[model samples]
Target chain A: MTTDLTDSILYLDAVSVSFDGFKALNDLSFVVGRGELRAIIGPNGAGKTTMMDVVTGKTRPDKGAVVFDGSVDLTTQDESAIASLGIGRKFQKPTVFDYQTVEDNLLLAVEGPRTAFSSLFGWRSKVTAYQIYEALSIIRLGDLKYRLAGSLSHGQKQWLEIGMLLAQNPKLLLVDEPVAGMTDAETEETARLLTSIAGEHAVVVVEHDMSFVRALDCKVTCLHEGTVLAEGTIDSVSANDRVIDVYLGR
Target chain B: MIKFLFHRFDKTAAYFIAALAVLGVLIPILNLALPEASTFHIPTYLVSLWGKYLAYALLALALDLVWGYCGILSLGHGAFFALGGYAMGMYLMRQIGSRGVYADPILPDFMVFLNWKELPITWYFFDHFVYAIAMVILVPSLLALIFGWFAFRSRVTGVYLSIITQSLTYALLLAFFRNDMGFGGNNGLTDFKDILGFSIQAPTTRAILFSITALMLALGFIVARAMVASRFGQVLASIRDAESRTRFLGYRVENYKLMVFVVSAAMAGIAGALYVPQVGIINPSEFAPANSIEAVIWVAVGGRGTLIGAAIGAVLVNFAKTWLTGTFPDFWLYGLGALFIGVTLFLPKGIIGTLTARFNSGGKGDTA
Candidate 1:
């Protein structure tokens, strides 16, 4: 029961969501601290993505409320406004602007605070484009900056999307399946990317790749039937009976 | 950087294309000075007729703003256009005043002919062109806001959204056709004596109208360009590419879509208002779904996602249609349909798109 008072960045009360007589998220509650890496793993239909959706304003919860930065009520705000409050999301499929170059994709993602409009008149300003370049370099995408996003390989696209998220400079990042279909090396690299960014920003990555999750060695949250089934280190969660049943097909 | 904008246009045969557009605008003006029956004599009717096509080009640009960049295919845009036209038409009808044949001064001649006792209360203040201009832009904007609010917030999309939009215009077509609707019914509000005291039939007036059309087209381009370069356009692009994903990315997807949708409708409205004055007609035919579909074809033929391409497509297709129908009246639809099919299959990006692609490839992007 050691709740870190100084670091909590997000607080989700007993939140729930129902769609057409089915419960997608059932009374889930959790807290994420500032600059922490949280990975959510679960069986299919475990509502992991739905939880992310709720946090990011894609899905509205039927009950309960969310607080961000310890004060901002996130329940009523629109996605853009919520995003303005410093939340960024990367989809499972890595939705970058396909027709745009990697550089353009990052340029388009400069959102929330000093987003697309402010940058135009100030694009050549030394600090801003430099920041974009730095984000690209952080994702190791600086070499392929001129390539169209659609031309990127799967792992690269994932990294590009992560770079886009990084370009947004959100305080909390909700990344879904960051390495869903990557090679072993790509998966390892992605884990490293998350780890590198974790100390400066809180990251919530939803993935099924155990090795990737193990590699990051972050807090593990196992979800089942839309609620937390277990929460601990990867080793302890894997040994839990309920988590084993859900992950190993009972 | 405008790097995208410059690259997009520079490689798209912009020089030749621009020359043709300038020709399209000037021909109607140049034909005005020709003698009535001389070899160079061009009919005034033809000039106005071509002007109508330019108005349609404006509509295509408006539609492209939403449909091309935002992925919102509004089948009901015709309704908004007609609404603006009707607003202006109301002002025009009021301007007829005591000068009308019936001389009731209060009611338009059609209202008096239909045995209406007095002017419809809503018909007040429309006698002024200033009011007409305001209404032309305002009416479409209001209608778009209300309709878009309901349609988008409710999460209506794809074919369902299309059907609703279709029904909206169809409903307007029905409402405006009534003799008691105060819009002159099927005959519509025509026989315009003046637009702010200028004889609309005069060649000078014609030239002014033509130039205004060109100016409006240019302004429309600039405004659309500015918007697309803004954060507004990025949201629209995201909506086009991955709407659901955008929603999760913290965009109020519906608000962005709705705002652009309303703005697009207002642009269409302005186009329609300008159209009525030049063409000397405002009728329910403007509400026809086929007309809207033709507008879509104009955008599609030019390029679905390209803003200026839509305007170019509108002028070129209508110009071609005029030429084709005049020569081969029997097979115009076949030619038009074939043109659409050919563009779709062979050049899915439209003429500007295909040309730009080649241009970019020529520049050597060096695909990995």
Candidate 2:
């Protein structure tokens, strides 16, 4: 059960998970408020992705509570059920149905009747059309709507996956390394796209690129081991002695 | 319903149906109406053989519905096919009434030979044609429902799922071979006298059955095409490509798999039901894992994801088998192996797929 946490859209208190005797997330507590865009930065094994996994219901925490929208307990649900509750996750690698068209990828990801019969009958609605249109423009792939997703370039595929998340209409979006291998221009466009989306949705981004984090210009949380090591403005977190010692090679 | 059926209709499917319809009508006319001495006349034996191929094409189409579209490779589809045949065989045995060598009016010849005094309780409703048809559909679908529920619920997929499906058919094969199981023991059910009071061996009856088989194949193709053209089909393709991603996008993957699997099983059952009468036998040999694998090969040779391709592959491969076995019996298996290898190497997309790629659209991008 979730305790009333009005200030935060998501509340994770003392969440921990382990795999094969190795603790991936240990005593980690975090929160994201409604319509707030937050950035999480960490080294390779600092439990950044594991936290996303826990929030998205892909991996169950060994102990603790994950409350979403103030009261909905995310850990109690499975991946699809959790998604139905308006929580979306973008994987580190851009994963779309490669054989399908870009428009079809968004249409399949649209928030609607997820059951077999409803989808089989007719899942297309006005709302879905509007969302697909919006997503195509957002991802800047309007002309490529009919193109197979597999044929898209690497950066384009990344944008298409983001478009898929937008079509989902999620309340809280967990984006992992969204600009890992993008061109400089593509990264800049992605930053603008994500920034524009912030005021309407709670977006939590995890990345290793310091420039990208600075471009986001949001409150930053730097993780070390399995807990928050520093939390503040980008400059302040980067200036922290422990962060400089453990993450940024001095 | 009409709109939905026509919605997915394309040139390939249209041509497929046109070909089947021509064959359906012309085969009966050639075999029944024309004199046997005429060059245009087709012999009754060839008509029955082609009918068997049509039934097999239906089976391959059913397999393609799941394996090709949904990516659920079932290596035991023959089990469903065999179960359907057994249901039809039971009804045919009942039609024998009082014609057995032992002169028993109630029991079939095998039961009479075994000195059984009464029919088994499992055979209760099979005496009626309607009930037998229902069983032909229900029995396979029921088995698929139960099996798919447990396997998909637990997320057993890929090669593991294929292996289990093979094991399922093998287990059924072993069970049906036993004499005490009441399915005529190792001999299985055969020597059916009539169906709906029509003589089983009559040319007119055979023609009707052949026409029915062709019609069923066309219907199955249409249904499969409509499904793949729907939103549900998109979701299924997404599941096949990236299952975990589809789940994260909010689809109950197991339910979709279960629904398609059950539909596929019912189609296979119907194929089997038609097969028994045309081939004049139903036996445990139908449950062989090799037969199921052969069905997979047919789909692969036609085009794994293309419904029309699968049907064509089934007929083409079976025709080759019949020809090779008769003309060069010793080289049949080796030729079959080479065909599979050649398809894997040069025709990876299959006969129809490669042709479509070359003639229709050049790019990999599918038209909306």
Candidate 3:
């Protein structure tokens, strides 16, 4: 119930979600402390992505509650509200603005309070720009900022999407399979980038790459059938009985 | 932030855009001033006609907000336009005062002709230009809000959403066609009357209407341009391309759609209100589904997402309509159809949209 950090950022207690008749998440209790890096690994349909969905306000948990910033009840909030509250999510597939420049795509992720009624005057600011470039540096796409996001390579596209998440300045980031489709070098670099950002923000990376997970070298939690099966260091979780049977055992 | 702002401005082609806007205003003025004696007296009505065209341009601009950016192709824009026109028409009817054939003193000519007892409840505010103008914008926006909230929250999109919009407009057309509606019914609202105590038929009045139309279009252009340039605009584009992904990226895609849709409708309403006095009539024809469909053509012809391009398309197509109807009457519809197909196929981005493609381009085809 209590997150161990200077400021408890995200906490989900007994969160469960059902789609149609099937339970995507069941009695899941977890807390991501401020600046903590946690890797979530599970087999296909272990509800890893579903869990992220609930946390991001994409999917409302049928039961239990998700609390952020110690007091903000996430269950009643929507996705944009959650994001505006400083939580970002990167999907498995990169979704950058294709027609926009790499820099523009990253810049678009920068948050501002522009509403439909008042936006007729247009939004103009300089602070958001600096944050965009700073994020591009972290993902190492600063040089190709002028190139179209559509023209970027697959790895670069993935990196650009990650950089976009960074621009949002989320206190908590839920990244799904950052290395899902990348070369060994790209995957290694992604692990390093996520690791580096972990010091400033809580990161829940759902990655299948065991080596990349080991590279993260953070607490690992294994989920089976919508519930956490094991949790600990990679060496400890990898050796757990059920964790070996459902996932990573292969 | 300067770099970011500049980058988006450039992406939106805000540089040469000022020049195009100047051309948009000047060309009409020059055309109107040119001495000519044609069968249609084209120059005499050119300003007012073009003013209405500019209003249509604003409608196209509004369409771009939802369809071009947010990926919602509403087929009910005409309904919103007509409702605003109806509100303005009420004001015009009120302005009629005792100037009617019967000189009933209190009622509009139609109401006197219809043998109504007194003015309807909603007719109370038409006497106040300010309230009427405010309703011109507010009414459509509220309708859009209610409709969008239900449709989007229920997850209706694509062709289904388009169908719903068409149905919405069709329903409005039917309702407005009724005499008991207190609108003009089948005859609609039209007469020789004053707008603000000045004879609407005067040359000076026409010039003023044209100027107002131009200013409104310019305002629409600036606002629409700024919106598509902002962070919210980016979220809207993201929603257009991939709603589910945007949701995962921590955006309530429907709320964004609802917000922009309502704003766009209000813009269309303003366009329709300006259109009434210029065109000299506000009929139920304004609510026709075909009118809304033609709006889509205007947007597609100019460029769907490009706000200025939509404006360009509205003006150009209407200009062509005037000429084509004069020259070949029956063939205008065929020509209009051909034009739509040609734009969708050959230019894809419409004229201005294609010309700017070399600078700011997307994937190979239309996102629609």
Candidate of highest TM-score: 2
**Candidate 3 runs further than 4 Å off:** A1-11, A31-34, A69-72, A111-124, A128-130, B1-43, B149-157, B230-235, B242-259, B326-329, B358-368
Candidate 2 ranges beyond 4 A from true positions:
A1-4, A125-128, B362-368
lDDT of 1 by residue, B63-166 (tens): 99988898888777777778777887777677667888988777888988999887787787788778778888988898888988998888898889888888
Question: Candidate 2 chain B, which ten residues in sequence have the lowest lDDT sum?
Answer: B359-368
**Residues B9-85, model 3: lDDT tens digits:** 55345643565467455645565665565343336377678778888988899998889999999988988888888
Candidate 1 is scored at a TM of: 0.90
Among incorrect, acceptable, medium and high, the docking class of model 1 is: acceptable
lDDT of 2 by residue, A1-250 (tens): 2333767888989988999999888899888889999999989999999999999888999998889998889897988999899988899999999999999999888887789998777566445477788999989999999898998988999999999998899998999999988999889898888999997999999999899999999999998888889999999999999999999878
- DockQ winner among the candidates? 2
Tens digit of per-residue lDDT, candidate 1, span A181-217: 7899888888998998997889999998888899989
TM-score of each: 0.90, 0.97, 0.86
Sorted by TM-score, highest first, which candidate order results? 2, 1, 3
lDDT of 2: 0.91
Q: How well is candidate 3 docked (DockQ)?
A: 0.29
- Residue B133 in model 2: lDDT: 99
Which has the better lDDT: candidate 1, or candidate 3?
A: 3
